[model samples]
Target: MTPYEDKTIKDSLREERKKLKDMNGKDKLWYIWEYYKIPIISVFVSLFLIISIASAIYSNRFETALNCVILNSQFTSESTSPDDYFDKGFRQYINLPEDTKIEVNHSMSLSFEESAMNDFTYAELAKLSAMITSKELDVMIGRKDSIDHFGKMDGFTDLKEILSPEEYEKVKDKIYFVTSDETGQKVAAGILIDEADFEKKTGLLIDGPILSVMINSTHKDTAHDLIRYMFGL
Candidate 1:
């Protein structure tokens, strides 16, 4: 070979060796993935964080929905305003106040038996129709008192025997029936209306299935607001 060609070949070999030596050890290992590791790890971490946040938010929403249903079912009430009352009518029975008084009084003069009976038969039959037909009064009597109906009953054929025709009509359709005794008689003689129909018949506000005692004694604004929110007012 010529000396000039041999010198050029040696120089090329030396340059290649220097480049390989410079890239040895940790530097070579780091370069293998240096351009991609940081971004890949960052993307995975970000995805995990986002998924965790979404799961937490979903769990919270489920808990909230469950709480709302439970509260609404337990603390139903009647609305006082005409508009609110109608809105609640399809869902509940309501007792109305004759007038807002300094002292709101709830009377419990009758039992579930009496209430039921009064709903189906007049007081006269209760007093004197003991031997009437089986379907005459027994089947007709309701099991509870009508508090919101203001002690009223509609389609009560016998109420005129106890009340003036005018008085009976004024209060009958507005009556609410409750089980006279805690052991209610299973009489299906009274009117069965939805919340709205009850309100229309009685002129009262009602929300859910709360007891009479609770309705008369408790302040209803919070219960009403909760119901409105839960059910979407």
Candidate 2:
């Protein structure tokens, strides 16, 4: 309205503009402090640096350097005890591409005798064997000497009792189920199968506990995946 009021407002605007221009002419850091400063920027910067360092270290770890991980391979080892060494060794063997099917032979019974090591109580092993046969995936099971044992244990008896005759036949003898007791040091049986067979036989889409343990003692994640896939969890 009034000329005087307008002049006063214009003077205030000029002063503000002068201050902004002066600030812009100063060091960029100073300008940042003036108008773009954030209270927690320092914290965010620190966190970013920390995460970057951690990622670098992790990427260079021995395991990472070795490139040891499973993709889609399938394998088996004795599931008697939780031997971390054997489990790790097995994991190293099976960690492959997602296309790799890891089938595992697992015996549920615990007979100490070499002949009875993979008896019927080992329904898990039977199921795995069935899975491998059904999927026609290459499987490695047992130990060095147990290939013979695997041959003897072949049948539709146990699996047929639990699954359809066709299903049982599908996995009857299609696995390289070994019985390498490793000088009687390892358990009697475990078998490997494809992921599809695992889902069909165990009704789970992931590696079951028996197979997971054989792969790695720390394969609880695999076990969880198996359960989750099978149960829709």
Candidate 3:
């Protein structure tokens, strides 16, 4: 048998150490790299993968109950984060469990004006469409132009279908209707918010903000509740 094939792990290690001990510094480095590069690289790769998986698992440990998007709105103060105000308020309002999570995404911005359309605007629009298609988006709050843009695309659920009679009656006057592109009929696509009141409550500044529920929301009931919560109804 060949010497390599006959050597045990210990014997091979000993022989390697003897060779390394006899070598110059540069030669030892080259020899080690030549002999152990694959194992060394494999170890690092395995560690990286393990850490990545662990981080992902830790981040996703909590169940996501609601996902709301607030487009084109900025916080009143630099220190005011979504988690500190809006998310916390909604969690308290609904008495959500500690283990459950609520996501309020306010970073995305889009403009409906042809003159304002750019790469960023198109990217945000694509992201919004993708979220709706995946049923990951529940509620949307934005200005009339933004709401109208999505409403015309059939992005929002008709309020009449989801809200109870009493609930409908309460916000009937505040409803924002849009023409459905497919049905060629007016649908209650959004609810107009009292921007001043909303600003006071959430510390977010938006002009003529309107709230709408996504058509394919997995959490329709929570989205309905969010409307009432936002309006303080």
Which candidate number would show the highest TM-score if scored against the true structure? 3
Model 2 Cα lDDT, one tens digit per residue, 147-200: 344434442112222334554355445323332334432332333445554434
Q: Which ten residues in a row have the lowest lDDT in candidate 3?
A: 77-86
Give Cα distance to truth, residue 4, candidate 3, Å.
12
Backbone atom clashes (below 3 Å) for every candidate: 28, 29, 0
Cα lDDT of model 3 by residue, 82-176, tens digit: 67655787889998998898888988898988999999999999998889888889999999998888899899999999888988999899999
Ranked by lDDT, top first = 3, 2, 1
Q: Kindly provide the TM-score of model 2 when superposed on the true structure, using C-alpha atoms.
A: 0.21
Q: What is the C-alpha lDDT of each candidate?
A: 0.35, 0.38, 0.87
Provide the lDDT at 86 for model 1: 32
Model 2 regions lying over 4 Å from their true place = 1-39, 65-89, 92-233
Answer with 1 or 3, whichever has the higher TM-score. 3
TM-score, cand. 3: 0.79
